[model samples]
Target chain A: MLTLAQQLWIGLTNGMVFALIALGYTMVYGILELINFAHGDLFMLASFLALTLVGLLGLATASGPVVVVGLLGVVLACAIFAALINRTVDRVVYRPLRNAPKLAPLVSAIGVSFVFQNLGLFWGGLPLDVMGGGLAAAAPKSFPDLIPSTNLLGDGAAFRITAKDLVVIGSSLCVMVALWLFVTRSRLGKAMRATAQNPLAARLMGIDVDRVISATFLIGGALAGFAAVIYGLYVNTIKFQDGYQNGLYAFTAAVLGGIGNIPGAVVGGLVIGIVRALSDQYIGAQWQQAVVFGMLIALLVFRPQGLLGANVREKV
Target chain B: MLRVEQARAGYGAVEVLRGISLTVDEGEIVTLIGANGAGKTTTLHTLSGLVQLTGGRITFLGENIAGVPAHELVRRGLVHAPEGRKIFSRLTVLENLEMGAYTRRDPDGIARDLARVFELFPILAERRRQAGGTLSGGEQQMLAVGRAMMARPRLLLLDEPSLGLAPLIVARIFEVIRELSKSGVTILLVEQNARMALRLAHRGYVMETGAILLADAASALLENETVRAAYLGE
Candidate 1:
């Protein structure tokens, strides 16, 4: 049997990663019922941009404050770029279909996913860049131990808990909590909820409905981009098409927790993360999809409303 | 003051108000009483910009406002409390009231008005923290009215506030309306309960097939033999 510390460590790091990606899925689906299929890829693309920036600026080997600031610059650039791109998606794909049939926007999302994936491939190509040979191919970047103490928790025979894991887990919790407060206490957040509940009533209340929708996409994209940067630094590498699998997993988390509900999404993420980590430990990685998808299907069968969904009476 | 000159509006392809005209003077409680599909609710909706007018003109306070967006109308102090008590279900009674005052910047004054609403309907204050959805049909209607009043509107458009409520509750609501009218707020009330409507209104319009069939003082309409037999249940 695994020690309590070891199990906790695994859960924490894995949970952090899940929470980050889960925020994207939850926020997007909250306002727009469509699952943004391109979101995961968008996160992946952000990581790639950061990696490229680091390599070009020679910040990969830079010392102390320079490396820290370089990283900040990368994160900021990625976040801004991601938000802009997300806003673009809202304007070009989602907004036009605001009054159209729902299926139209959904189909367009799938097409966007492919377009982004191919664009990444064209840039990265088949062969990885020749700088660090297989090292660059295997791991695009390695963050300095910025997380302070990776070995804070007592070590064990099987799994070693690190400061990095603690940092990841802690940050995700902070971000999620912050998001909760923003949505509940902030005016714009209430406006968003109002828009979701009754667009007509919200419009009557003087809310700019279109602006609120656009803001949702922008914020969701920025969070995803920010998560991508941290994920890259945590895992140390990301492929051009990394978003597909990550996006799918995050989407599953959103659905599991209850789409449109922020707290539910976070809970869903952590639950999925723990389940995936436990499975990875015992049942081998390949069995992951079978287990997760099976659970998802079963949940749907039993409670189609998800963990926190209100009884939806919306008819097609 | 409000005026509709040959105003026409409807749902998509289905016309509900066909060149219907009506007027309400300042501080007047004008009631439009009609059968279910006679465009009473539709007329109110079109006045508040909820229904799009296909033809004719709507002038409120001497400004053309036929095609103004619904919320914009609220901003301009023309608030609609809607047919169903469309109170935000998830929000608490207090939050729902706050949303009604979204266009206003006077927090202290808004707070004072809220106090007045609570004073007006003590039950709503008792359930201030409760979800607006949990209220009884009557309470929801009162909250809906209270919410509209929070907007500090010059003209309040109430569509069938009496719909789906006990008569006692309906009486209580009409009393609130009586109180509001006494305080100088212009009201345009639409209702299918013609007897109760005719009793409260200064002027009354009888609507049929999306057009006005007759217009007269409320007491005059109440006494008219045909109107009394057909609408007032004589």
Candidate 2:
């Protein structure tokens, strides 16, 4: 029973990271109906940025309040960096193909994904102390143990709960709630929803559709940045290829939840996370992907619109 | 006031508006009537800047608005309630109205316009919380018109407002259009219902195959045998 509880906790934490990354997928899809293939690689680069910041600040060796403050700064920096890159890519690559065939922007996104992967590879080669003297460009670098692993329930507890788990789950929940409020309550957010439904109608309503789309990319990239930091601290290792593997998982979660639906992405992420955890334990870690994909196929066969999705679509 | 002179436009090599020209003076309701493929809808789209003009000039409120984007045109108070009544289906009635007021920053004025829209269409107020797609065709038309009104437009371009509605609902929408004209808002109306559009508009233009076939007073056009035969279903 305790073992089951421990796996569930791990699943929940892992699911939160997936949910954060999945939001980037779902938001961009909601606006443009284009699955941004570059999104996962963007998350990987943001993790690289976080690692670089940790090395620059020497927060890995620091103790107490400084670690918290330094991490907060790193999160902000990575978010801004990723957001600017995401926005710029849209402006330069995707905007030109707005009136082109749907396949054009999609192909462009894949191209951007490759470019970002190369950028991540190049970043890994930077001579940063945190990157083990930048020896191997393809190696999985160990993330700094900035977050203490002290189990909050004490060492004797069978179902261990660490401060790291609390931070990951707590921060993810807070970010999700804040995003919900922004989408449901703010004026620009309302405009985004309007544009998602019918961009022509939204323009008739005096909304600059291009601006709203850029904002979507910015917000989506920022979420990925936040997820990157949390993922590095939790998983403790990241590589250039991590984006490709983890990105596939996050993209699947978005589709599983219904491509354009926000709350659906969260639910899908949690389901995938729990499925992965349970499969990893009961079946085998090597069979994890097969199990998750098999369940997804079954669920899609029964409910193609996903768990929370209705026929009446609300993209944003 | 709006003016178009020999405007030519189309979708990428297919010219739809072949040098179409018309003018709407301030404080007048001008209607454009034509058959389905006669470029009536295209004219409205061009005026609202949705379709780019390939030739000639468009002047709105004394400034040449040629090549202006649709949303920027809205900021200048040239609002288009498009042919299909393209309301945001997922948004509530109230959100749709708020979106109409998107460019304007004046809170008190927006509030005043909101109240006026509600007063104009009480049914919209009743269904303010309901999603737009769930509304009946008549209700959706009302929501579309009410949304346009929320922009506090000086020149409102309404396209096929009475499309697919019952006769009573059509009459209600037309009556509101008349009321809006009386309240000092200039209007450019496009409709397939020629008889009703002629009765409501002060002046009318007849379009055929991407050009204006006739331009005259609405009552005069109503009396003309050609217009009556071709358009009024005589």
Candidate 3:
């Protein structure tokens, strides 16, 4: 037995990533009332962009904070990329269907996902980056274990936590908090919520609701781009096919967190992450996927409104 | 201050307000009374640009506002507080009022207008920070009217203000309307409560089907026999 503390630590560290990706899914869904199915693929594509950039820049040759700065630069680049891709998706796929049949945008989202995946495959080919000499072969690379463990909490009890784990947790918390505040505090945020509630009423209030929806896509894309940086560092690999599975999982995280609830995404992501880790540790790696999805099914069966979703009574 | 000429409009295929023409002189409280399906609400929606006018012209304050976007029409001082309250439920009463002056640039004047609305409905002043959805039905009606007043419109379009209020609340709302009319804010009131409406209206127009059936002074319509039998129950 690996001990409860060890499992708890592992679960928490992994949970941060889910929380980040899940936030993107929930935010986009809240504003548009349509899932951005291509969002995860967008994150995957962003990581690939970072890998390509790292290869071109020979970032591994640098030392100390330079490597970190290079990593940040890649993140920034991908943030811009995600924002652009998201904007294009909105303009091309969702905006035209704003007043059309609701299913049109949803189906278009799935089509966009496939199209994005194919574009990635076309660029990087079918081979997973890990397959060809792993990720180190893509560029001169070294995994920067920034934090040396300390025994501050009574020997091993101290956080045994590395700087990278701290980075992931801190960054995810920051992004989540910023997004929550944006939706609740700012004028544009209020407009977005108003539009979500009733677009016709929002328009009468002089809110350019179309503009708010576009901004929503832009914000969702930027956060996903940020998550890409964290994901690349944690996974240390990239592939064209990675997007579909990871994107679906993150979207599942969002649905689990109560599709339209903002904070629910964070809770959902964490729960999914811990459950996956536990299942992997005790139930064996092969059964991990089955275990995680089983929890989802059970949760759905008991509570279809989701963990934090509102039970709105729509008049027939 | 408001003019509609030969207005032809309707849902996609079926025509409702066919060739309707009417005028509201500056500072007059004009009321439109109609039976169910009499095109009263359609007329209001048409005037506010909610229903697109197919073959007509609307000039407000001497500007061709026939086909201006709905939001822009509001900035031009023709504010429509629609039939339903339509308050942004999640927003607080104060925030909803603030949204009323969304297109205004004069912050000070907007503030004054907000203060005036709160004065007009002190209950709203007490519940300024409360979520609009939490208010009683009567309070929500006041919030809707307050929100419209936040626009400080030269002309106001009120659609069925007494639709779903208690008799007492309905009486209070009419009194407020009378006060508003005295204060020089032109109103185009539409209502199914013909008795109370004409009692408060300076002049009333009765619509049957999609066309005007009768128009006369409020006192005349109040005593009109067919009007008494069909509406006032006198």
**Which residue runs does candidate 2 get wrong by more than 4 Å?**
A310-316
What is the DockQ of the complex in model 3?
A: 0.47
Residue A125 Cα positional deviation in candidate 2, in Å, after optimal superposition: 2.0
Q: Name the regions of candidate 1 deviating beyond 4 angstroms.
A: A1-8, A125-150, A153-159, A311-316
Clashing pairs in 1: A40-A243, A149-A163, A150-A162, A150-A163
Q: A-chain TM-score per prediction?
A: 0.88, 0.97, 0.87
Residues B56-78 of candidate 3 have per-residue lDDT tens digits of 88889988887787878887888
Task: Chain B TM-score per candidate, please.
Answer: 0.97, 0.98, 0.96
Task: Evaluate every candidate with DockQ and list the scores.
Answer: 0.47, 0.61, 0.47
As a TM-score, model 2 comes out at: 0.97
Task: For candidate 3, give the docking quality class from DockQ.
Answer: acceptable
Q: What share of the true interface contacts does each candidate keep?
A: 0.42, 0.79, 0.35
Tens digits of per-residue lDDT for model 3 on A1-316?
4455566666776777777777777777776678877888888777767666666656646676877788778778988898889988899888889777778898998899888877766556534442233432223222333233343344656345556667777877887788888887877887777776656666666677678888888888888788877876766656676777777667777778888677787888887778877888778989977887887888789987788883132221
By TM-score, the better pick of 2 and 3 is: 2
Write the residue-wise lDDT of candidate 2 on A164-271 in tens digits.
999999999999999999998999999999998888889998999999999999999999999999999999898999888888899889988988889989988988
Q: Using lDDT, rank the candidates from best to worst.
A: 2, 1, 3
Error of 3 at A226 (Å): 1.5
- The clash number for model 2 is 0
- TM-scores of the candidates are 0.91, 0.97, 0.88
